[model samples]
Target: MTLEFDLFWSFRSPYSYLATPRLAALQEEYDVKINVRPVYPIAVRIKGFFKQVNPLWPPYLLKDTVRIAEMEGLPYAWPSPDPIVMDIKSGEVPEEQPYISRLTRLGVAAAEKGKGMPFLYEVSRIIFGGVKGWNEGTHLQEAAARAGLDLAELDALIEKDPDHYEKTIAENEAAQKAGGHWGVPLMVFEGEPFFGQDRISHLIWRMEQKGLKKRS
Candidate 1:
């Protein structure tokens, strides 16, 4: 039987961006499926998230992500016009976010069309791969095309029932918490959660014991 896992991810997360190419590669090399479940970043989900955390966390996170990208030879940069509209200096999240909501909803639409993994990989790469104004112009449209989706069609689909997508995101978030973590790139296999990009090897080891096979 083919192995399967649910990846709770976020477009606004640098870690999610870091983990995706590896996940996509695993899908190619093994008889497994990754159910890409995109959710809003913690900055949005928990309004006071950054405020409550240690002040050192953000600086450490920046250094850690940068080193990881360098260590892995992955091109990385903080997204321009971050998906979550927050004061970087103040650690304050705003009430109105113009980017992440639509991006997350469109992730749902892509999954509904059976193209979720590709959609996540392509889009996140553009966003986190140093593309300035990644949300502008044809960047997203081109990414969608690469993922075997059309941006306009996905947008239209969501416009028909935006609430449904939002509901799905809510359900995914609830399920994510149930699966063990509330963070992006949380990979769950048979109810076990591997909650970081650094845990991919651990996740693969577990999958191996479960009889993962090479794709022929």
Candidate 2:
């Protein structure tokens, strides 16, 4: 028998990017299925979320992400055109978001194609792995290819009915909240929510308790 879990993730989240390689490894090594559920970053999900946060949070987050990347020996850099476009000075998110909406839609399309995890791992590397101009030229197309997907096809699906993809992301956000956390890189197994990239080992412990087996 295979255990299944939901992975609530976001393109703009450093933690989500950090979690990808390990998550992909887990899927390959264990008899488990991870349902990749991509959601918009909190900057877009909750208006003024950044503004309401303590001033210390952003700096601490930056410091922490860099250290975490070093600790894990993973290359790390913030996205070039941040998936969420916001005025960091004012903590104001723009109404016309040109990046996150498209990325989230593509993620949903990939999930529909049963390649969500690979897509997430490949695409996020471009965005967060020190690549400059990640949104330009064929960066995304190449990433999709690396994941064994077609970016053009995924884009066409979103172009056909963008609202559908948006709706799917909305549902993912609501589900994440219902799962007990609004953070990305969240893993929920049998209704137990484990938030943050650091919680992965704990998630596996729970899986072991549930008789998780290796793939034959």
**Clashing residue pairs for model 1:** none
| TM-score, one value per model | 0.97, 0.98
lDDT by residue for model 2 over 1-216, one digit each (tens)?
899999999999999999999999999999999999999888888899988999988899999999999998998998897888889888999899888888989999999999999999999999999999999999999999999999999999999998899899989988998999888889999999999999999999999999998887
Task: Please give the lDDT score at residue 27 for candidate 2.
Answer: 98
* Model 1 stretches with alpha carbons more than 4 Å out: none
- Residue 177 in model 2: lDDT: 89
How far residue 148's Cα lies from its native spot in candidate 1, in Å, is 0.8
Candidate No. with top lDDT: 2
Q: Write the per-residue lDDT of candidate 1 for residues 139-158, one digit (tens) a residue.
A: 99999999999999999999
Q: Give the Cα error of residue 13 in candidate 1, in Å.
A: 0.7
Score each candidate by Cα lDDT. 0.92, 0.93
